[model samples]
Structures are given as C-alpha cells and as structure tokens.
Target: MQTSLNHYSQNNEIHKDIPGRKEIIGYGLGDFGYVLIWTLVASFLTYFYTDVAGIAAGAVGTLMLFVRLWDGVSDIGMGILVDRTNSKHGKARPYLIWMPIPLAITTVFLFTVPDVGMTGKITYAAITYSLFILLYTAVSIPFKTLLGMMTQEQHTRSMIGIVGAFFIQSSALLVNMITEPMASGIGGQLGWVMTGTLFGVLAVVTLYITFRTTKERVGFVPTAKQEEKVKLSSGVKALFKNKYWMIITLFCISYYTLLGFVGAELYFAKYILGNASYFSIISLVKAVPGILAIFFMAPIVKKIGKRNMVLIGILSIILSTFIKYLDPTSLNYFLIGSAFNGFGKGIFGAMLYALINDTVEYGEWKSKVRTGGLVNSAASFGMKVGTGLGTAIVGWLLAFGGYVGNLSQQSDTALQMILYLNIHIPFLIAIIMFLLMWLYKLDKIYPQIVEELQRRKNE
Candidate 1:
C-alpha cells in the first residue's frame, strides 16, 4: 500500500486529467434530456390519470406505487449489468447512446392513452409506464455512473454535477412552464402527444451530444485476488456497509418523495387557489430562483462543504414552509414561499449527484472493490421508491379526503387535504432530510478516502 501510494502520488496522469469545458457542458446535457421527460411525468402524470384519463385517484396511486417500486428494484439488476459490461464505447456511456431513441419512443407511449375500457386503460398504463421506467433505468443509472467514471477527483466531478443540475433544473423549468398551457392550448390528448414528442426529440439530441462529448477517464481494472472478492453478493453486502451511502440513499428517498408530490401543486393551484393557469406562474416562481441559486453552489460548497450547504438549503425549505403557513391561499404568499423552495432545490440539486459520486470512492476504499454501478443503483432505488410512495400518498390522501375531479369546487375535506399536502407535508419532509444530512459525515473524510483509493489503484 505504501509503495502504491508513492507511485500514485508521483503520477498525475493516473487520476489528474480534468475534463475540458466543452466536455463538461456536453456531459451536463445528458440530464437535460433526462429531466425533460422526468419533470413531465413527476409534475403532471397524476393529473393526467385523474382528469384526462378519468382513472380513479386511488387506483392510479396504487399503480404508481407498484410500478415505481418494481422499477426501483430493477435498478439492482441494471447495476450489475453495468459493472460486468465491456463495451467499446465503455460500460456506462454505451447505454447513454443506445437507449435514448427507445426511451423517447417509450416516453410517447407512456403518455398516449388508448381508447378502451377502464381495465384495458389501466393495463395499458401499467405496461407502458413499466416499460418507460425500465428504459429510464437503463439510461439513468449509466448517466449517473458516468459521473464517477468521468473523473476520480471530487472537484471535477462536482463541476460536472453542477453543470448537470443546471440542465436538470432548467429542463424542469421548461417543462413546467409549458406543459400545462401547451396541453390546454392544444385541447385534448393531442396536446400531450405533441408535447411528449417535442421533448422526446430534444432528449435524443442532447443525449447523443452527451455520448459524443464525454469520455470515461476512470475505470477499475482488478487483479485476480480483487476480482475473486468482487462478486455480486459481496458487492451488494459492501454497498449496505457503506454508512455514507446509506445516509444519502435515505436522504434521496425523502427528497424524491417531496418531488413526487410536487405534481400536486397543479391541483393546489387549480382547486385550492382557484386558478389552473397559476400553475405556470407557480412553476416560474419556483424554478427561476432555483436556477439562479445554482450559481452560488460552488462558492457556498467551497465555504461550508456540500453537506453543510445542503443543510442550509433545507433551512431554506423550512423557511418556505413557514412562509406558506402565513397564508396558503394568497397567490402572493404561495409565490414567495415557492421562491424559497426553488432556491433550496437549486442548492441541493447542485450537490446531490456530486455527493452520490463521492460515495463511490468511499465504497471502493472500504470494500476493496469498485462498484460504481451498484452504489449508484442503490441510490436510484431510494429515488424510485421515494417517488412511488410520494406519488401514491397524493392519490391515497386525496382519495381518502373524498376528492372528486373536474369539479368547480372541492369538498371541504378534499381542499383541506390539498392544503396539508402543499403546506404541512413539506415541513415534515424538510425535518427528515435535515436530520439525514446532519448524520452525513462523509465530507469530513472524503479526501482521505480518495487518497487511499488512489493508492489501491496504483497497487
């Protein structure tokens, strides 16, 4: 180990190559592609199920829960496939290239509801949604793993993640601003079909740019002894043993849960606030501040570290909770509160993928096997499950509160339920996320972990 440390410290080429500006921006475009579709699904799928397709909220909720959970579980298999893959384009990058068009096709299929009976519609929803999730996993896990493979250095990886988050938030902003109005303007299923198609074309283009621009600089080449120990069961066990990974996974679940229910903002805007068009305005308020906040991420993270910056972001969320509490009905108050929410999301979003990639080095150092795919897969699992539950909660609670769709006025119970979802639940989620992030101690030891991993690689 000492000899390996000396050898690695003496050589810069082994781990010190920084990606160029074009490369970084190109890599970032991948998330733009991803979030274009992802935001659409997360923000409006529930509304489509209920108002557009005429499915019962509870049934849609159940389907979302089951399908998303299954999708989360499938990430494990995809991770293993990524680890074992030996492609010319590279393990993770190949998926970015191959999966985009199919993924785009599936995205369209996911939105296209067939003219059929209720059961058939449900089945169509299930099959199409499931296929879409599977394809998303195939692309998403690799895109995530590509961050770690892009560079072993934390700073470069963070830069990549920051750029990526910009795209994610920006794409989300674009989707949020247009989807509702576009669909309404187009008037009927045709609106959604056109929106999905446009986004799909854009997704394919950006992803191909990602494939063309990004290069995998870091890869694991295990010796015979190391290879023997890095089996599937052992890799899975090693992942569980990573304390930082566990904390981040839990945090991701909580974060994505919050995101899952964010779609309910449309309902909040339409029914509770009495204007459906305000959904765009709300999204505008939330997204613009969030986009601007990303510019501060590098400096703030430098000053306080990623974990602390995230903690501060959570505090911002808590503040938004308070702001909304003052007057949930006032569009003025809601917009003000949403600005804070966007700011927090921006900070956290900038840090999240970078933080997840950091865990890979820690995992490799402790386990003696580099399992980037597996580590990221577990994180994906948490995200999917959290999103599932979050989306389901909206449905279940709305159902429980006796929600009726397409009505000019909601029952008192339903209105109150929407209020709690928008106001109270975020507060609880913020607390949980804050606590989880507080428990995260990885940043303190990350440098040492990377140094140690570098030594092992040299050995």
Candidate 2:
C-alpha cells in the first residue's frame, strides 16, 4: 500500500498541468520585451556611442567594462530582493507588472544622446546606461526566476524556454533587420530616439500581457521550522556547491560572450562588406535558421538529452565559425557559416534556461532551501560579465586597430580586426562552452534528484 501511494504521489507531482498554453504564451511574450531592449544594446549601442555620440572606441570599451562590473554586482541585491519579496502576484511576477514602464523609459533615454560636448555626451551615456541596466536587472532577474516558479516539470519548463527563445530570436531578428534602416531613414540622432521610443512602447505592452496571463505555481513557501530567510551568502554558497549550477553558469558566461560577436556586425558590414545595409541580410540569414531550428529542438532534446544536444550545437558553431574565419572576405562563406551558427544558437538558446531551471531543483534538493532567485541571478551575473568582456574586447581591439567611426573606408588593419572579432572570437568561446558541457553530468542525475525531491515532499 505504501509503495502504491509513493508511486501515486510521484505521478501526481509529474503530471501537474497548471501552466497551460495561456501561461506559456504569456511567458514567451516577456522575452519579446527583453530581447527588444537587449538586442538594441548589444547590436547597436556601441555604434551609437562611436558614430553618433562621437565617443572614442577605447573610452567606450572602458565605460562598458566598468558599468557592467557594477551591473553584475547589483544583480546580487536584486536576487536578495526577489527572494525576500512577498506579494499578491508572487515574488517574481509582480516585477513584470510594475517595472516595465520604468524599463521602457530608461531604454529610450539610453538611445537619446544629447547634443552636448564630448564629455557631456560621455557623462550622459554613462548615467542613462547605468539606469537602464539597473531597471533591466530588476525586471529580467524576476522574469528568469519566474520560469522556476511556474513549474517543476522539466518538459514543461523546457517548452516554456523554447517558446521564449523563439520569441527572443524573432524579436532580435526584427530589431537587427530594421534598426539600421530605421535609424538611417529617420536621419540623425532623432531617428534613433524615434526607434527607441517605438520599441519602448512595445516592451510595455508585451510585459503587461505577460503579467496578466502568467501564474506562479511553485514558489518557495518555507516550512515552520525553516521560516527564517536564507542569507545571501548561504544562497550563493548553495549555488556554487551544486555542481550542475556551476556548469550551467559557466556555459552561460561563455555562450553570451560568444553572442557579443553581434556587436561587431555593424562594423563588419560598413567597413569590410562595403555596405552598411548588408547587416540586415546577414541578420535575416542568421535568424531564420535559429527560428526554424526551434521546431526540431524539443524532439532532438528528448532523443539526445539536453547536454548532448547542447554539445552538438556547440560543435556546429565551432566548425562554422572556423570556416568563416578561414575565408573572412568571402560573403558566401560567411553566410553559410552564419546559417550553421544560427542553427546551433537556436538549439543552445532554447535549451539554456531549461538547463538553468534544472539546476534550481538540484540546488533545492541538495541544500534543502530553494534559492531560485539567487541561482538565476548568479547566472545573470555571469552573462553580464561575459557580455561586458566581449564588448570591451571588441571596443579595445577597434581602438587598437585604428577604427574610425563614420569613415567611408577603414584601414586594412581595422577591417581585419573586424573579421577576427566577428568570427574567431566566437569560435574560441564555443570551444570553451563545449568543454564546459562535457563537465556537466546533471542529465544523468536529474531523474534521481526529481524522484528524491518528490519522495521528500510526500513524506
């Protein structure tokens, strides 16, 4: 009778369907807002600073590095806040409702460079950018934390993550394809201001819909004996002690660092390809493969497991990037390589959050405390560090290689550096990611962890 009861309890835990299509779609829409802001910063912010704001490349690099370090530090405080939050909408979801307007406003300010002297422009950039990152951290940390709160079923979490990836990539694609033309067509600084405003409004609407439609089903409700709040240090310690969390955190750092290669595409198109608008075609090619890859992601993950699938995807990116590096001058080769890279990116991007969500469970099962916010925040910290480093590398290298903004043609040296930044750096990062995935053994142990947690819950 006890055995039957245990089996029934396990089945009940596994089969809970509180998050259906409405919640999944709502969750996915949040990424639409996220990627709109993120892609704008990642793909165009440096360009705006250099060409429009007239900041030097070296200064831009130094500023990004400094700001992102501060940004990463701030994530810990945000994580603590999320963990301690008690609200009608739950810990993470309320941020979705309350913070989007601030986020949108800050995003607009980030793109709005004032018509001031160079020092004034730099100061303006720093202040607005810092505010934007802080607001983004408040909203994004919660949105990511929401995934773990919504469901314990790995499959359901994976589905939500995959759908989120689809939306994120789609939003990124639209931003990439249109941003240059939109900015140029509108003409000058005013054009960028308009573009930021347009997306800012969209961000507000989508985030509100996400807040309205999604429900948090699996928040940490402490037992009477465990009611005291967990210290931030304890949460951080628990996160590092979970081997899988460490692996995923390492992978995210490497993955997002590789993604920072997008920052160089505008330079590559303008200087190397000899057409500023070629970036649109490159983005379109890259995005389509990733978008199409989503259709196959779930079945592939189920068949091969997330680790193997991720490994396969990383391998594809490494190989494709190497090919692009070998013939950097050939547009056909670059496009082909980008297509493969996009496929790999699609697979990895879709599965990444699901993998992180698993680590939340692993930490909980081992530590006997749920540190979902801390775990996700730590992951965000790593990503912010990687992004900062990547952007800094590009900026510093451009300065070193003598890149000048608004020049019709670049020196051969600067063009070569753009090629290296656009291709080889990403390849190296992917190799590191591949090594990190090899160290991950969570896929083998996750079922045991889940079953054990379920058993403990029932007892």
Candidate 3:
C-alpha cells in the first residue's frame, strides 16, 4: 500500500479516474434529492402513516420490516445487473434516465393516504414501499458505484462525497422545515397531499440533474456476460471476501440505523415540545451545521485519511449521545446535542464512499470484474436495512408509549414515553456504534494495495 499513492500520484491514467467537478456537484445534489424525499419519509413517514394517515403502529413496523428485507436481498441481484449493462452511456447512467419517473411516482405513492381497511393499509405500505426501494436500488447502486469509478484518490472522492452529503442533508432539511408549514397553511388531507406531491416532483428533478451531469468513467471493458455474472452466489462471495468492504458495510449499517432515528425529531418537537411548528426550526437548526460540514470534509479526510475519519465520526457521535442521555428529561439539551450529531454525521457521511473507491480498485485487482452498481447495491440494502429497522423499532417503541400520532388526542402517559424513547434509545445505540467501529482495520493499507496491483499490471 505504501507505494500505491506514488503509483497513482506518479501516473496519470487509471480506471474510474476522478469525476469532473461539475459532475461531482451534480451527482451530489441529485443524490441529495432522492435522499431528501426518502429521508423525509424515513424520518417522518412512520409518524405520518401511524399518526397522520392512521396505519396501526405494529402493522406499520411489520410492513417496513418485510419490505426492507426484500430490498436487501434484491440489492445483490441489482449489483449483478449493473455489472452486465452495456449501454453507450455506460453501465449505470441508463437507469438515471429510466428510473426517475418510476422513482417519482413510487415516492408519491408512499405518501398517499389511500382509502382502505386496516389490513389494506398494511398491504398498501408493504407493496408500495417494496416497489419504491427496489427501484431506488436500481438507481442508487449506480449512483454510489459511480463514486468509486469517479476517482481513484481518497481525497478527491471524499470531495465528491462531501458535496453529495450536503445536498442530501439539505434536501431533508428543506422538507423538515417546510412539511408542517405547508401542510398547515393548506389544511386537511389536501394539505398533506399537496406537500408530498411537490416534494415528489422536486425529488425526480434533482435526480434527473444528477443523471445528466455525470458520466460513467470506469465502464466499457468487454464482458462474457453482464446479467449472468451478477448472481447471488457471486455477489455475496465478492462482498464477504473483501474484509475491508465487510467492515465498511457493517459500520454503515450501524451508523445509519442509529442516525435514521434522527427522523423522529419531528415527533419530539411536536409531541414533546408541545408545538408542532417547532419541527420547522429543528430542520433549520440541524441543517445549518451540515452545510458547514461540507467545507471541512476534504480537510478532515485529508488529515486523517479515510478510515480514521470514519472512526472519528463514530466517536464524535457517541460522545454527543452523552449529552442527550444525560439530559434525560431536558428538551433543550437533546435538541442541542442532535445538532452536533448532525455535524459528526455530515463529516463521515460522504467520506465513507471515498473508502469505497479504494475497495472498488482492490476488488478489480482481485476478482477482475467491475461491479460499481453492485457495490452500491450492497450499500443501498444497508441503507434500507438501517432505515427499515429504524422505522420498525421506532414505530414499535411509539406503540409502547401509546403514541396514537394525533398529538391532539394522545394520553399524557403516552406522550412522556414517546419523549423518553425518542431521546434516549437512539442515544444508547449511538454509543454502541462507537465501540463497534474500534474493530475495523481497513484504513492501514491503501498505499499497499495500490502498489501490489500496479506491480502485477506492469508485470
């Protein structure tokens, strides 16, 4: 690994060279759009479904759990599909054009309050969500894998990621800030329907921009088979073999699972703060630091390299939880700590993909196949896993607290329990994630892997 930096530094050409600057910003913003829509749903959707839309709590949890499991399994196959695609635009970009319409439609559907029986609601959520995330994987895997093919260096890729994270968080921030005001201003079912439709459109447009701006850099190697190559056995084997990849995926799984609970701040603000309007402020406050995080990302990754940045991010979040848990009953401290958690999350958020670029290089050297989309497929599943589990757990907990979603109607006992779980449980999970990361070992070998691969290519 020692000589690898010099290898790339000294030589100018390589597979999946860094993406152009315009492409970087475009992808970041585009991904942010998709993430924004989904994060809103993830953050507030359960509350929306249970409290607002009237889906039962356990049913909502169960539906999310099932759909995410399906999404996880499908991710492996989608990765294979990306590897096999032979488009003029490249492996991943066609999905960019084809996916947005479906992506947009499905996202809107997830938010729709259909007229149905209790069983019907659960079925609607499970089926629509399953379809939505499946399409999401088809789009996102390519999007994420492009990061690897976009650049070879840790710093440059991290720069792209930094920009991407900003867009994602910003999109969510925008939604968080606006959803209530927009809904309340308009009033009733029409208000919610209007808000969702607007965001849904924005989501598609942003993703379209992301697709238009970026070019697939590492595609065009001839292959014996694209579809056949991406089998479940092969994809799973490939992921597990890369010890570093497994570690990265695990950390990501845990990181986002804990972080997904961040979505519940709406519940906290509305139910606990006793003012649904404050949800808007929560969005504004948390997002300000995320924007600032973009400026600091490159330098942070540059100084510590990528893996340590992940470690640092983990530790930072863990410590922030101390403030949250210690406060226990204090809303001020919990909200304040959440902002810092957002900051820590923003830093490592995009940097992790920089590490992924290195793994893509390593995988190419070992397996002699480029599965950028497949790599992202795994990541998409991990995201879904975190998100799915976050919703499942939160909904279940909300049920425990007797949160009926209608703040106007919920019992005082239920309100207090809702507040307790919203603040404390996620905090405990954040602390566990910190300890979990201490076990990773991928950061020590970037230059080593590069040197070995280069020597073989030369020989």
Name the candidate, 1 or 3, with the larger lDDT value: 1
Candidate 2 on 396-431: residue-level lDDT in tens? 999988988888878878887898898877877888
Candidate 2: residue 347 lDDT (0-100): 83
For model 1, the superposed segments whose C-alpha errors exceed 4 Å read 1-15, 220-229
Q: What is the C-alpha lDDT of each candidate?
A: 0.86, 0.84, 0.70
Models sorted by lDDT, best on top: 1, 2, 3
Q: In model 3, which runs have C-alpha deviations exceeding 4 angstroms? A: 1-11, 15-17, 223-232, 366-369, 407-413
Off by over 4 Å in 2: 1-10
- Candidate 3 lDDT tens digits, 1-459: 112222234353453455666777788877677776676666677777877678887778778778888989888777777777787777777777888778777877877768798778777878888888888777777777777655555556667777777787788788888887887798865777777788778878887887788876554554344334556566566766666566667666776677667656667777667677877776776677767867665665677776676667666676666777776457677667767777777776667676666676666556755456666777667767877787777777777767675757677767766665565666676666666566655556666666665565555
**Backbone collision count in every prediction?**
0, 0, 11
Error of 2 at 323 (Å): 2.6
Residue pairs clashing, model 2: none
TM-score of 2: 0.96
